[model samples]
Target: MKTLALLSAAALTTTLLATPAHAAVTQWGACLPGQGVDPRQECTTIEVPMDYSAPGGPSVTLAVSRIKTARPEVRRGVLLIIPGGPGSPGLNRPSTLVKKLPQEVLDRYDIIGFDPRGVGKSSPVSCGLAPADLSLTRLKPYPDADGGIAENAAWSRRIAEACARNGGPLIRHISTRNHARDIDRIRAALGEEKISYWGVSYGTYAGAVHATMFPATTDRVVLDSNDDPDPRKVSRQWLANYAVGVEDSFPDFGVWAAARDSDYGLGADAAAVRKTFLDLAARLDREPLAWPGAKPEQLLTGNLLRETLLNALYSTANYPMLAGLMKAALNRAELPMPNQPEEAALQNTAAHAGATMCNDIEWPNSIARHEQQVKRNRAVYPLTAGMPVNLGPCAYWPFKPAEQATRISSRGPANVLLIQNLRDPSTPYSGALKMREAFGQRARMVAVDSGGHGVYLANGNACGDRTVTDFLVTGHLPARDRNC
Candidate 1:
């Protein structure tokens, strides 16, 4: 869900184990059958006040899960796996994480994961968006062929209104601050005075806020694929960074395609590959292919090609998918089917993201302002083509932020470790630096010479993996910021 494209079917763009004492004690049970669930994961629920300010008000249940360390005697504490996406489903993260985590790290901590209040297995929210509004193009909408966003503006209003109409009180309550509070609640439920954390993407912001708000209750922290924690911009900054991120990451694809020109006739070199992609996108914009659910009238246009290009830069593994699709499009041959995720899941995540992003900070409500920004952005960054600043649901959200955005500070334990890829397509390195700056002396950064949305164990950066693992195993941080 890092790229809004990943879960933006229709443009909606889309745990832990712990046993503790008193209020934190959980009753674990078998998970209801679901995809990708690890059998070893035990599940349960925690009832939290829907509105933390009103503790006695109605409550919502969050599905929580955990995988206890078999080597309990050596267990140090609970390790919460904070997931990315304001809409990202995380109940199964513990299961997925167990496979990737080093044995020593697993032995030292009971891995925990949870579906935030409005995600899978937890209470979910949906805007009941019409099928038309749910198309993949809507997630990161492009301006009209002539650089207009009248339709994009319409989609924003429709989505924002739909969310307010269909979303219940819980949607209004799902803010990053609230998510941070929920994390604290989980910590209390686990009966831990301080919890260790490994947060990724948007999770890094939540974790940063958690460490900021409840610094006394946090132990070792690993923030991977960080977000800019500027209280003023918040999610708006995240949205804008997509343009910069794409610019930074697309070169990797260009070079890769150029090198493998024999397999895929994109171009013979980096410059040639870049020109080929730009030309193909422009050509498609002028002469679209038939696609059932693409935006700007059910046809594959240049914008969709650009969107696909942005999504493809997310991982090297996805390079072939984009390369092949481009080849097919260029040849006017059989194109691969657009990969559509389950619709209901898309709605849930879209609504979840809508609530969290809009509720995190106050967005400029003027559609004109958004259009103006988009126009300026489009001129400077052609790769993203103004999608970054395009009118989105946040511009018309139903409620104002319940509270101010959390400002991460240097006033915490020196336990936060940041690992970032210099060319992450989703969360750019420049934004990660802002996150590091926000944390100040409280965090140490390991700038890996790699590319992609995630780093540490994920990017196969041995130095990064070891640095993070060593920190988790023994509360030791590097004396100074280092490059891997």
Candidate 2:
């Protein structure tokens, strides 16, 4: 549901030649403030072609950052942190990683981070969409009252048109395939013979693409909360997977909420808690509530409430955010929603996400077909409703994908490691199995008996954390998949 930070430093790239070598130069310097900055972090930039097809054409700058290990004597190699999100910013991840990662792991390599092209300080692009269209509920594309998709269809067309008019040429080239290419460019600029990698959520897909494209150059690869790398579907499949993911994860929230029914009164037990959520969502659908700063057009509608639950499902620490809101809503009280990003940031995120997903693979162009999927998904997955299929971009996207989506192959090194929560609300376990299958014998999975989005160094599962930490530091994986 959220993208993790990877790097936050001043990464600026020099112009380069068109060959695959991408003969580029890197000059490291102090990072600008506020991209997960740490005093120890150094920032630089690398230039990668906007469109890999035309390497001689213009390039986009990628902000790269690193925290070199204090124990240079024991330094193993470069460990690149790939940020999550088709639209997530990088450059500040080294700062965040320094705090979360074990010192032993941090001491082994020059941990690197970078903003993908068309994101953050790296030649950002936007669709200039209206603030209303940028809201979480609208961006997720929930259907109108009575489950009709008329508004969703029209909004999709409208946003697609906005992106076409304002996104310029750079937006057209943003995709996982290009992200992998940019990573290789970073590798070349770093002068590394091989690089180890860590990518979470969407970063997992990006890292997979890198491993598939440049296998031999990759040393150790770790993918946490992975996406189903089904080449034919790619991001389109990810969009629809919400139905299954939410269904898998919501039960954990339900049990947790039910245990504290005395505090929030969400439900007396797990079954009751589930009922309360469904019923409350239905009631809100009929009549939305008001909130400060939501504007007249944006209120706490049923879909918005559903969005809140989806976000809260990511981590138990954030569960109180949802519980408080649900309590307030039921009591007719006011509560603030989390993460009200500025309109400009929202526009950029929407544009990048739309371009990356739409360009990754073709989506059904027929609005009627989308509506049909919405109807089917809504009935089966009441928690997420039909928002999973109620897309507002790909169906009306203005351009065909510049290149085919990357197929994550099993021919890569078996150094790949996957860590997942069985009940992830974003990248569900069923889908993770698909990614595991795609890699075949090339990967080992650590299925943690936890309930959260991120697993390694997150969620506080000692078994899961120790396994991944051992793998990263020692380069040894379990003989087979393990359960923690």
Candidate 3:
């Protein structure tokens, strides 16, 4: 799958009809059959076109799941949870959130989740990449020692070519605009006149597009960990911003590493911890160490160290894992083993993620341009090295985008709510502000003074969680932006 967590992972309208094109009667059935479906959860599938331009052509089924409110008398339609990771699984999201959300959220609406096209259980696509190529270091364009990008460029071409060869026609259709259109279809399938949405990370962009494209049918929209909808630069902007985001978040990691009283013994303080990390990374660059159980060869290089840091930075809960890895590396002992994703599942994720990113917009094809950008970014943002601006499969994407990217605007209804963490690494507060500005008067933001990516229910901030829950349940908005 994609290494970038951000690329990691809406709507109802009822008018009148019971035909094939109309809303299909959702025959709720057993969910997650082999994966232990909850008694309260029900599952079903809906058919959508491989290409919307030819709606009558080939179609793909999207898996959907729902947990209806226990109190039907006060039920307020459906609340769709939009997942992050353009490739992250979502059919089980309702199951995951059911335990985390307050009863108020679970009681007010039927919680819904689904796997998008080209993802799990939804007519999946796969590039069939070799296990070595699928590793995090190779997935992201981390340059080789001496700052050479020859291997990165070759890998980028290989990935792009593999997707083109194996991903089929559906690959080109996997994009944000089409994703928004699919949401309307899902809305119809649910037979709801209007639906509320709770979207985080990349889902925020999808939810925003759905609201923009079908404002009249949107209700109580919540966009958390926003993305910059710069029409010209969609995922490209997100990829580039990781340099800044990583630098912004590394201090938190440093503080945590310094405070630990365990075997990591990274440093006595934040500054020293950062220095230790830098020294370790430089040493790894010079002499890559073996890490048994790691795919291909178990080599721990500088790139892997940086990737581990980025992965661990997503949540405070993951700090210890990185520390453990650091300790193992420091002692030159066996490193902590990682749970490798199933080969087939990983292929599907990579195909979906790479196809969607490339199909969304054309990326710069000039390796020279990327080389310059990477060099400049590396100098300015040493925490991320040059990976943020380095070449990836997008640079050699086989197909041009199917359509122009959607331009987000404030022309939609004033039903949007933006929730953001001030120091998010993936979707930084700076980018969230751009999304907020794009919505203009259409949205009121709830800024949480947090360090992680997601906010609202997941951030453990009561003020933010209450603001979103109350809005969904009672259709109220703050007069202005509120900071928690």
Candidate 4:
């Protein structure tokens, strides 16, 4: 449900580029102040047009960071690490990856990260949404028992209106295509002839588009936990796939919960554990539980349980948390404390998700179609309650997309390596295959026998990590797609 941060920083010293707004230069300075700031990391800024079509128009500043190797004698080139969520900023990515990445990888290239335009330190966009409306349950619609989305439609209109009112011209330009263009600008600012890239989740799509549009400029490309690059669907398909992904991932949690000698003591078998979960969810739906220090309904209902489960499946480490939550709820026990993000941060994240998704392409405005899809999805995948197929702010988005979604092609240089988990709860193996097929022979995939969203250096098997790191260091892709 949340994209992890991989951003690290470099300090800044601004210098004007000889080129116009589209090709501004980067100026390096010291890391101002933040967590996990390494002395090795430098912070800088790159200016790109708010709209690429109008290169001479007003520009927006993108906050960029990099961690360069100590041994420049061995430095190969720049490695741009793209962040997911379109909303997620990458300024902190390098700090986290630096500790886990092989020294050889660190020695070979400077790892660069940035807050995508309209995110984080970059020129941001906000809807000024109410705190109640910013809740996750509210941001993602959960239909009523009648399977009607009347309320969701209302919320969508309100959200869209708010965003249109508050998010300036910049919001309209936060598409994947613009994001790809931003990456190229970063490359030019770094003065790199060609750059390597590692992109995860949404980052994978942006990287793929970059590779497609500017193949000659790409050196090494690694796409992890990929999304389906179906040009016609884009984020809509990614959202819908959540239903399938949750179904595939839930069993892993069930198996863990039912393991022999499990300390949680929810059930003796996987079936029994699932039953316990379903029973509790039904009970909550009938009688929502009061939750202190929570907002929007401030009640624990079945939908929240479903949403929590979906979020928990992002990492195996969250299995215990979900299990404990269930156990507490089933005992009529007090729920464990929930972690809440600040209201402003939530607003920013929602704005980014909306702006980027809506700006990428048009979503169907037909409530009837959305209702049919939700009802069908609920029947087929009850675990997710059709939330994945429900209407979002994009349904009522005000502006037409500035550009059509990019169609990923095998027309790129043969330099891409994709690593995916067999049962990723967010970007499942099924969707990953689509991205792999989209790239064709231009890419090779390493399917890890794992279950989680992120792949390399986070949730993937060591073999997958080794394959990616090796590709980064030596530019050697697997002879064929390999499973780990």
Candidate 5:
């Protein structure tokens, strides 16, 4: 999930709970069979109107699952795990991550997961993109040397058209606002007065919107790897932040590369390692190496490295891959292409991500503006090579935003906790700071001195994890900012 939207401190408690008239009326039953993890983890289908305004209009099914508390005596209520990827499904999370939680936490709450509309196990939407069209480099935003994006623009138009034709009506309604509404509907179905939430990446944005639209319903929230909720920019801002993120995390990779010089032999010093990478990328840009069995055998330097770097930034465990690639490229030796995600899986994921980004807010359609911005970004931040600020398929997407972006206010209860990495290559610290500022006194931020995406149980330091866990367990937070 991407970062969440903003919330205001309005006394929205009155709107938090379902009305008594609606409480007993559970339109969607307990979870259905063969959906997620344990059979005990119930799954159910909820039919929601395709268009919210026309409650009785064409409807689609939302797939949901829940694992009730293992210990009824300590059970508090439901804790929703919001998945990132505007289109990522939460359906199997309860079986996966929920089981990882400490026994005490599990004992206190029923864990819930769901596939948002147009996602897995729900009503899915696709752009029907060809396998070639799903390549990481191709899907990534890249600009031509002359700062021209004619190719990108054309590709975007093609992708948009495909989605328009194949996505059906569900594609148009994939914005964050609607997703929040869907969460609320799930809350109502669960028959809970309020819900605690753990939102990661894009999930944070969904949680924020839910809090803003129905603040009182948010019992406790943990927003990890936060993104700035700037309505005007949205994902554009996120992409731009990648440049800063790379600058921050590259040093960690540099250290690792330097340390392994004897084995991989990329460089003897950190500075040399950096130079070697940049040089290799520059050379690759001019003449790509042919990688056997790869989608595009001719590996363009920028894309190959960018994709590799993106994957590496997921966690320190991946640093070896980057190191090996760097070593192979340095010696002009053959390097294997990264394994591609399954075509159907990639399409589904990309379509979901695209729908969420496209529907979250409107993107500027001016090619001239995007071209100029890309040129400036390339000149200023060569590491990212202007991909961050370049135009996306959303620029040519067929749908308009369903609603204005929600503004986050700090007016809700002080129950929000944010955990962020200082040098995250995906979500940068600067952006997390923006989220912290937006939440103001209502949230406490624990900034970890780590170099990767994700926090909490993932890339988080012990101090950071403890902070979040303490809050989830005891509802206690530091009075102010704390650096880990």
Candidate 6:
């Protein structure tokens, strides 16, 4: 993790070319076709050079959108909604999430969203991976049968080779540092002196980079479900944290599974429910049940249940799906696989996710070390079945980290406020604490007594939402650390 800190510092000092100032404010009248957004929401295209340092080089067009502030008297500046996925397109978010914001917040800002480089309507990149390689179950980090990531290592190598052959030079520029510069370009295009933002999941990493690179231009930045910026470990650190996340969040699923025993016929007690899940996963490891429509020819029950459980942890609303899947498996009934979106859509999204994660940081190239860790992780965190700590495309990523990972410093303004859930399955509390410690007293943290990801307005308690909303609306934070 400390390795990441050094990398981030180095990245900050690296020279980035500046864009020429343009006075033209070209506003387009039409909305993006088929977005179903309100007519008042404006859509347009902004051309950015593919390589920022080479201003005369080939360029890419980033799609941008904004819903203007309804109240002119109280208008402040632009509120940028940075999307996650290293590959997620935020092009339509302003018309969606921004509309739900409190009027006071809306009045003070013009909500904006853009497709990050190599994603959505922005200039895209693809590895041209076969359909079999695009499965969610396959894309997820999972260890080999012998509790090793040798296969993952090979997969990573294959992906890197494919991307190199097909991704062109644009793949090299997808790093978060470059994305921060892209945001700055968007800010310049919008003609705003400074920008406020709400960044979720991987988007938080982008926001942090933006703030670090251009601290003076940031205002009211909200980083939700934050990622640890340790450049050495990077996404690997995130995958390993899932073990802690499952430990933190699985208990909630256990309680839910036990309470619904009468309906699901899974178990009469929470302990029994927990044991049943583990037992079933172990059993499936030996004799997997057949599942139609799933990738890899047939779905192993353990991996299927693991996939279901991970998706379920995203929100409480998906609990019943997990419960139903458990019931079907318990009854030895035929289980159906969930429908995947169109092939083109899946390929596009997977390519973007791969590019973003692989480009952000360099991964360890040691297969033996990954195998040792996965074995130890599976033995201790059986509920997660060692999938959380497994390797992905980064292990064999062709490029070294563009810059070392960013070491977060509390040297800036104390205006930053953190809102976290006690048991976030994706970004667990333990990881959040690291981020909190990194920020130090430069920021205040409000820990909500809740579960799931995205603390505010997504899966958080009222106390948590009020803390964040109050900060956003009034620019005041609690004088000290507070727990809800």
- As for TM-score, the candidate ahead, 2 or 6, is 2
Stretches off by above 4 angstroms in model 1 are 1-5, 8-22, 292-298
Off by over 4 Å in 5: 1-40, 145-147, 296-300
Global lDDT scores for all candidate models:
0.84, 0.82, 0.81, 0.83, 0.76, 0.73
Q: Write the per-residue lDDT of candidate 5 for residues 177-199, one digit (tens) a residue.
A: 88888888878878888889999
Instruction: List the RMSD of every prediction in angstroms.
Output: 3.5, 2.9, 3.9, 3.2, 6.1, 5.8
lDDT of 4 by residue, 1-484 (tens): 3411111222222322223654545468886677777777888887888878878777888888889887799999988889887677788778878988899999988989888887777877788887777766776788865577998999999999999998777778888898898899889888888989999999999999999989999999999999999999999999888888988887788889989326777788877877777778778888888877666558888888877887788888878778887878877788887766666566777888889899898999899999999999988988878888999889999999988899899986789999999888778889999999999989999999988889998888788889998999899899999999
Report the C-alpha lDDT of model 1 over 1-484, residue by residue, as the tens digit.
2232565321222121222212665479987766677888998888777888877667777778999998989999999988888788778888888998999999999999988888886778888888777777787668876678899888998999999999876889999988998899898888899999899989999999999999999999999999999999999999889999988988889899999998889999988998888888888878988865433246778888888887777778788888998898888987777776667877888899889999998777687787788889988888878988887888788798889898899997899999999998889999999998988899899998887888967763899999999999999999999899
lDDT of 2 by residue, 259-312 (tens): 999999999887888888888889899988877766424577788888888878
User: Stretches of candidate 3 above 4 Å error?
Assistant: 1-23, 34-36, 261-263
User: Which tens-of-lDDT digit does each residue in 60-152 have in candidate 3?
Assistant: 777889998998988989999887767776887887788878888788889999988878877777887878887877867788866778899
Consecutive 10-residue window with the lowest summed lDDT within model 1: 9-18
Q: If candidate 4 were superposed on the true structure by all CA atoms, what would the RMSD be?
A: 3.2
What's the distance in Å from true for residue 281, model 2?
Answer: 0.9
Total backbone collisions for each predicted model: 17, 17, 11, 22, 21, 7
Please, what are the lDDT tens digits per residue for candidate 6 over residues 324-367?
77777777886745544555555556666777777777766676
In model 4, what lDDT does residue 93 have?
77
Error of 3 at 125 (Å): 0.5
